[model samples]
Target chain A: MAFRVVHYINQFFANVGGEEMAHIAPELREGKVGPGMAFETAWKGEAVIVNTIVCGDSYFAEHEKDAKEQVVAWVKEINPDMFIAGPAFNAGRYGYACANIALEVKTQLGIPVLTGMYEENPGADLKDKILITPTANSAAGMRKAAPTMAKLALKLMKGEVLGASCEEGYMPNGIRVNFFEKERGAKRAVKMLINKINGKAFTTEFPMPNFDRVEPGKAIPDMSKVVLGLATSGGIVSKGNPDHIEASSASHYGEYDIEGWDALTAEGWETAHGGYDPVYANENPNRVMPIDVLRQMEKEGKIGKLHRYFYSTVGNGTAVASSRKFAEEYAQKMLKAGVQACIMTST
Target chain B: MVKEIERVGIPVVHMCTITPISLTVGANRIIPTIAIPYPLGNPALTPEDEYALRYKLVDAAIKAFSVDIDKQTVFEF
Candidate 1:
């Protein structure tokens, strides 16, 4: 007997209408519909889409509680071996609907669930909780997305153990699953080293965390009228280290008032950073925070005014997520204070 | 931290010893500094000279804010 599967899609893929029909509520249709056909082809008669649940993107977003209850009830009644919802691509609302519905089915009914979406979709925030195969930013990627989802779905239905996210083509979900490699660790390391030394392309087993590149903000039109803010990951603070920012892996940042200060005298300020020798920064805190030069610039009209407060934190061994959160908090303060530009120093 | 500040639409220049690390972390504006321990100052120099060097670097960083750039840029001083 063919393994039974339940598929989910939005109104756009269901041919119910475009944005005009996106308000339509959840409905069940027997067998594959729209992109389900692509999955059907990939399944190769090994499994059949026993049912498909279609929901409007807007309806799902507006009535999430009601929609989830309906979808879970329908899935329970059908009781398919596996559940799949959307290769939603870049559609934000649809991706949300698919990821959420898939999560609900897995948790509420204990069914294996799978979905796909573009990495930037807000729904991808749930990637760590669900199996999300990355797709291109548009529905044109359906051809590739469907097959990848189907292959993973089939394995999931067969109750087979899964491999690492990289090997299985799913987003890294923070769970480290170990598997045997064809080559031993020592041999693999040697081969990689040789490839690197020879300048040959070789994929690293552990890649650096991918950073999102932000477009440069438009340049300040005139420096003469700008309120220049100063910030640092160099850990310069008051001589006493009032907020007690950690020397390494900082948990918090300090905001100091230098409103009337001209230079950071050795007696007045010091570095909280443990990553480097603190002698120079301690002798002259200006080395790491540059308040002395910025004050001079303010007086010399090189800049309009120096922001009164400076934010400081130690960057040594700090997690990128923590760093981002600290900056997000202080960046809002800078913005609210009418800071036009900023210079950040790191040690 | 520099990237996050710039992401909020505020122009920010990162002054650090390792420009490559700054580039990798997606900082849009970068200024190479003397060393990790004293990014804006040089203890070997006379106080006046070290002060001058720090001033020059800060000036360069300020200038970076007014120059439009489409990609990550290292502002050399």
Candidate 2:
């Protein structure tokens, strides 16, 4: 016997509406609507898309709570063995909505929900664990995502233990479970690099570099009138550097001060940033800190008063959540002190 | 770090040698320098050249405080 499956969707996919229907909240139908039929045909099981809940993008984005609960409730009623959502390609809100719905459904119904998304979609970050397949950037990726999702969903329907995400043609969800038989990332990187250097076909463990662009703000007016702050990722530290900032993904930051025109000397300072060659920083702390030049700038009236303290953090291997929190805290502290501008140096 | 700073209404200028990393990490306004190990003054260059480079990049960074853009803008030296 094959397992029954259900599908979820937004208004655009449901054909109920497009951007106009984006505010349309979740409403379930009895049968396949949009891509659900394609999914139904691709799956091996008696995959029945029991319902299609249509909601608008703006609606879902603005009212995630209502949309998520409604979708979850609708899927719960169906009680299908499997669930699926959009292989959202590059559409930020849609991908996010689908991922959110899929994640919520998996949570409430205890059913595996499968979907696909491009690497660029922020949704992947929020719902990677909820059975997300990596799709290409556009509609062109539909063929690849649809079939791959179907195969994976069918396997889940059979109560199978899924393979690694890459092996299964899915994205790495950042959920690392120890299977007890594998080298660490550092070792794997070394081996693979050696192979590549030797002209062998070695695979890279961490191919994609993680980067997330933040929304840029409007630039301020009157640089000379603004209070300037310094923040460094160059592993700048106090004279003693007590916390021992990691050479990479530094664990802690220390604050220092010089009411006078003193410069950082290697004899008293050390490098804690692990991501790069520490010898340079260890030989001359200014290489990473550039404190010498910044101080000179302050004296020359190129900028307003330098903030009394500079925030420090290591970038290598630091988790995004913690790093963000740290930055927020530092900013809050600076703002409370009347700081109006910042010059952050990254190694 | 730049975003967090700007979130509180303070303008930010990110000086970096790793432009791509900064771009990917979402730095809003950036001023590019000579190198990573030495963002401002490169030890390899003549002291005068190093000072010239550092002074110019820093000048751009300070200038970035006033530049307005609709999207992420990268500064090159």
Candidate 3:
């Protein structure tokens, strides 16, 4: 039987227009949009992209959960055997939206979800778990990626064993594929290196896309009476990470006040950051949150004052969106407290 | 924190142990600390030695507030 496929697209790709039209709500339609049509026409199997549902990046980011649910509900009715979204080049928001929808569908509906992105989009960070195709930053890479993604999608839908992480150009789906490979990782790496040395084109065994580096802000002014705020991801907590910050994948953050105390003790403090070895911090609270030293300075009148509260959150694989939100809010809180300086510590 | 705070137009200074990691990370206006694990103090040293090191580093870090540089600069112990 011919497999049914659904192609997800954004407002721009659906030919709906640009940012102004991004608020276009989720609606279903018969058959594929621009790229979806290309996929259907180019696919090997008798797989037809049954529908293309278009939504804007602004709309999706503004209404993430609703957008996911709506898309899922639509796909449920269409009942696609496989789903594909994007060849989302460097469009961060669009790539994120497609990745989110694809990830949701695969996890909830038990279907294969495939997407593509340039090496620089942060969508790769979140959706590296999905069958994300390796793509160049422009439409130039579209021809190569579409067919590769289509072929892989068809194979996955047919329950064929996909190749190892190194052989496949897609990001590691985090799904372990047990295969009796003729060569192990080291052997394959050497072969690829040799190929490249011989003037033959060779791709990385594990292709990790690049990330856009945010320019660090410039240093603050010099002032005699300024309060410095402290933040740590070393998992310093009061007795317990009472906030239930995941020992490895923490998403929750907590802030506490130390207006009167000279030091934080391990008797009531613990480490919540999962990314680091917590042994030193667990045995002695001062190892991570040096509230004691900061306290001494306060008593000595070295600085004007301490921000009554110190902001904290775990930084281990936490989403960029969440981290930025935390940072913005924390900065605002410090501002409200009249804090002129900050000393955030991350593990 | 120094970078972010500075963005809001407040003066700031960064302090860290003299380590390759700190240098590579491009910290600006660094005040040298005693060690990596405990930047301000050495666990192996006597209490008086540790206190001296912490006081020296902290003093330098505090003093760094008055100094200004266009790019990254490290403070010697």
| Top candidate, metric lDDT | 1
Report lDDT (CA) for all predictions.
0.92, 0.76, 0.71
lDDT digits (tens) for residues A17-99 of candidate 3: 99889898887888878888667767744798888888888889999999999999998988889988898888988889878
DockQ of each: 0.79, 0.44, 0.32
Q: Each model's TM-score, in the order given? A: 0.74, 0.58, 0.63
Q: What TM-score would you give candidate 2 relative to the actual structure?
A: 0.58
**Candidates in descending lDDT order:** 1, 2, 3
lDDT of 2 by residue, B8-31 (tens): 777778888878777777788887
What lDDT tens digits, residue by residue, belong to model 2 across residues A1-347?
Answer: 65777776777777777676778767777777878767778864456676667777788899989878777777777778888888788888988988888888877888887888897898888655677888898868777778888888888887888777766767777776445437777788888889989999986655765655555666777666567788887777765567777766655565656456355677776667778777767876766666677777777877777778778877778767667777888888888879888888888
TM match of model 3 to true structure: 0.63
lDDT of 3 by residue, B1-77 (tens): 33444455544455554434344544455666544444445667775675555666665766665665666667675
User: What is candidate 2's CA lDDT for residue A257?
Assistant: 64
CA lDDT for candidate 1: 0.92
RMSD of each candidate? 5.1, 8.5, 6.5
Interface RMSD of 2: 2.0
Candidate closer to the true structure by TM-score (higher is better), 1 or 3: 1
